[model samples]
Target: MSMDLWEYQQDEVMSEYYQELCLSEFQERAIDEFTAERLSSYYVENSNLLVDSFRALEEAQKVSSLSPTSGLIMAAISIEIALKIGLLKPIVFGFVHSEAVAESISNAVVKQTGIDRFKTLLVTLLKEISHVDIVTYKRSGTKLSLWDERGEVQKRRNMISHKGSLSSSQDCQFAIDVAEAILNELLPDVLTSLNLHLQNKVIVE
Candidate 1:
């Protein structure tokens, strides 16, 4: 199929899936290795924060007068962590999708693939985001569509933050699962087009 037609079909299918799941989904999981490394670092950092908060909660439980306030604070922190974790899925998705599109374009032009070329694609992706007008960025360029999706995810994050809106643990899990589905569907096509292998490697900082 033509790129435009394929993208349209992707949108249609993803939209239907999102409606059924009540979650946003991406087309691929083709994140650059560097981006994955950064995200892994972020997860580590957040895990530390979670550990500290849990420790504080444990200490507070031992104190009678401060227990109520401590419990409330811990609950709020837990919710924040959950939302951040939820947000991470889409943020990672955006980076991967953006990088994959750029890589596919560059590989087609050069008829060869290299890690450096992929990194160049990543730099280009970041530059596009940096130079665009904030208000119009979502519609301006090839990778800009990811920014639109990012905005939607941010809105959900806001609801989670201000309204305590995520209904249950299942809701949060669904968000992550949708993210994975989006990546899984899109990444393989991009990799196949580029004649590149998607290896399963642990991305560390």
Candidate 2:
């Protein structure tokens, strides 16, 4: 289905669920306000952090050959900052989506079904955010197995952080490259997911 059609359908489903579940008006309003305030604050804080990390990474790339240990340290710091910011963007977006779903569901129930079912809608919205896989960590030999690419990225990131030993210019450059790749591939995807969740008002269930 077209994205717009899919979103309309989701809103319809949420409306039905809300009416069927029967939530209170007060509870529904509270969830809406709370979600908005929290999401706004989270976005402000995280976006700034993301920008700062991006600037640092750019500066690092221009530097002449760095000592192995320095390169690894800098790369590790940059990656950590980038990943944390990336993860936060989606989570905040998911939270906003949940809130919107709750609001839409509440409105639909009151308007169409004449039911007071806001509590269940709010609970379900929270549960959806709770379950979303906004970020995943891939350690070696873990239950949620890392694919080859992710595994390689993780290894390189780790080497930069833990290897500490002197690395050649090539090794340092490689670490920087890995960090750059992760930032490029993961950040945009995270932002897009957040925007989709917000625009569509989708819940996990």
Candidate 3:
């Protein structure tokens, strides 16, 4: 088949790379290993969900007084996103060779679980991945369990999203508290385990 200029250049690059790999001792791995090694770095670099979550939290805070309902929704969304990307993805990726498989399983686990089972799933994920005792995690200056706060805030968020119910400033603050607690308490450990660092609002190793 005739190749375009870009295709010809690509083939030449691949050929040179293949020849270099053939001579290298590290090239003896299986194709899946090669794929994983090449793709895993890309996944980690792009998959820091906390970056967006922080942005959401900031927005939630700004709108808390002006629009409590919006604040509550954004806060809840941030927590949900952080739970999946910050906690779930890197944890599950460690157990799989391919990022593709880890991604599919993560999506399915989050999607298939209903609201009733959400707490159980969260408990299991935190326990297995972070070894965190969810029951003992309390919000700042309050005796409220972080897990229960997460549940209540999220339930309110669901009511707002599904039934178009308006939220009070207190509810917005409640959701924000949950977001802040999770971000402060859980994020550091999670980031450390993944060898990730937050710098100037960017997440990196």
Candidate 4:
């Protein structure tokens, strides 16, 4: 029932998630190429915000008569934050090598485009920079593409953000699940691939 408890739980979840990802052998490689300082500086704050909003949702769910609007909003923001993190990580990794790419990512960050636009930008950026088509990339070490749309999480988030609608606890929980999947699986994979590509470029040049 407390945000502090929720925060603690969130931290635990992320810590476990990161630990698993590290076992995949991506942690050292990604950090070596991407630079831990840059990634942490660009990501840590928004990542914490994501956890905060998720905690807010959890706290609200404990109240039976409370409006679900706030929870829905938090869920939506969590999705957006995950997407932004996905998009910005590559730029942070590559910025020092390519100012033009960095400038482009900076512009996208300044505009803070919608979720769909952000996805498009992310997909395009990955392909342009690394020839990796993210739309086709599997998530969570599974064979399913990240954009399979089976969960309808983005639709729910859009309804809340753009139309001022609210979702039930079930849907809100589903959205949080989707957020966790993206944060733990999709973003790391994309960044790992990007870092590999950047490292190869460095070697080839």
Candidate 5:
């Protein structure tokens, strides 16, 4: 059917209005996604958790002989605990939903049952805090390389735990050092908030 001049003009106006409407909708969605919520301070109330982890690492350094193996494993665990503290800091300050805690707890249970591919505590903490995968998170200029070195600590800990592998004093010391480096590197804010004065402590303890 042929359209008169006015009919054609009305159709053109309607098409232009439709395009503008779509553009407005797109801009609104973009703005909503681009906006970021202010992150809450996490270091105030949960300071002790980090302090206790540091204390445990210090004590681990002092132990001798075969027992140092246990100490080293505990140091690795302390680092993991500190990272968990970091991840939960936002939750403590009401930055994220409380329901996320319940979800994480349930997922931990399922993981323990070997029902699915379980993420390591460190990996889980990294994702929660950085909102990215491990590789991308590491690219953000974190100095300690926890993604690579912590896995070594875990493997050594596992060997000692599962196969009764002999651990040297050097191995224990390395674990403690790596844990300390990571703590000082990644969680400086959390550490400063704890007022633990960790930098002054002796490395060998």
Candidate 6:
């Protein structure tokens, strides 16, 4: 809890599953009344899911040592969520400017009822809309984007889920790092478009 919020009471529930909220510094930063009025629900939903992806990153790190496979799977899930909701959905909505069209496209991309694969959709959207060619989007000072970024971890997650493949702490850490990097790299654009500031124990930007 960054703000040490004083609660009047407590819920008779498990704190382990509770998620912390980002208390916006609206007092310090002046609110844009006009923009606030025109804000889209797509933006709000995407922002919340992006925050969830980050939260999953932290949870994966926390469990990396105890259960490597679980950690790896969690990190992989975070990557996929960040990819769709964090980057693709917002960018699509930004261009289309119609929530209905955007929602339909987003659902199709995410659901993928054997029409197009999830990974295929992700690459196509990144290349066509965002102009981010992930294949050529190399890591800084290295030609390591081939597997270190997203694909390898996703494959590993599939293996673990379908084939019960065991994983190591190193694998878990790598997945966690990749998930965090992808989310962090794409986060600024989403936040800026939404005209929102983010802060918490895990995220301070």
lDDT score for residue 71 of model 3 = 94
Report how far residue 205 has shifted in candidate 6, in Å. 12
State in Å the error of residue 88, model 2: 4.8
Pick the winner on lDDT between candidates 3 and 4.
3
lDDT of 3 by residue, 1-205 (tens): 8999999787666545433432242223322233323233644567555788888899999999999999999999888777766654444444445567655544444443233333443454445444676767776687877777878887898798789999999989989988987876676654554455566545666
Query: C-alpha displacement of 77 in model 4, angstroms?
Result: 0.9
Q: For candidate 4, give the lDDT of residue 194.
A: 36
Better of 2 and 6 by lDDT: 6
* Total clashing pairs for each candidate: 4, 6, 0, 0, 0, 0
TM-score of candidate 4 against the unseen true structure: 0.48
- The number of the candidate with the highest TM-score is 3
Better of 2 and 4 by TM-score: 4
Q: State the lDDT of candidate 4 residue by residue for 1-205, as single tens digits.
A: 6569888787566555533432343433443444433443444333342354344435444441365555555655555655554454434434333546544434334234454533544454556445657677654555656555323666766677788776787766655555556655565555564342113112110
Candidate 6 residue pairs in clash (backbone atoms < 3 Å) = none
lDDT of 2 at 200: 22
Which residue pairs does candidate 2 place in steric collision?
Answer: 22-117, 23-116, 23-117, 23-118, 23-119, 68-167
Candidate 3 global lDDT: 0.64
Task: Summarize candidate 2's per-residue lDDT along 106-199 as a digit string, tens digits.
Answer: 3454445211122244334433434323234233344541223333444655665566445567756655665665566444433443352222
Candidate 2 local lDDT, residue 79: 62
The model with the greater lDDT, 2 or 4, is: 4
Per-prediction TM-score to the true structure, in the order listed? 0.26, 0.42, 0.67, 0.48, 0.52, 0.62
By descending TM-score, how would the candidates be arranged?
Answer: 3, 6, 5, 4, 2, 1
Model 6 gets an lDDT of 0.56
lDDT of each: 0.35, 0.46, 0.64, 0.49, 0.49, 0.56
- Between candidates 1 and 4, name the one with more favorable lDDT: 4
C-alpha RMSD for every candidate = 19.0, 17.1, 11.7, 14.3, 18.6, 13.0
Q: Which 10 residues in a row give candidate 1 its minimum summed lDDT?
A: 108-117
- Whose lDDT is greatest here? 3
Error of 4 at 129 (Å): 7.5
Q: Give the TM-score of candidate 6.
A: 0.62
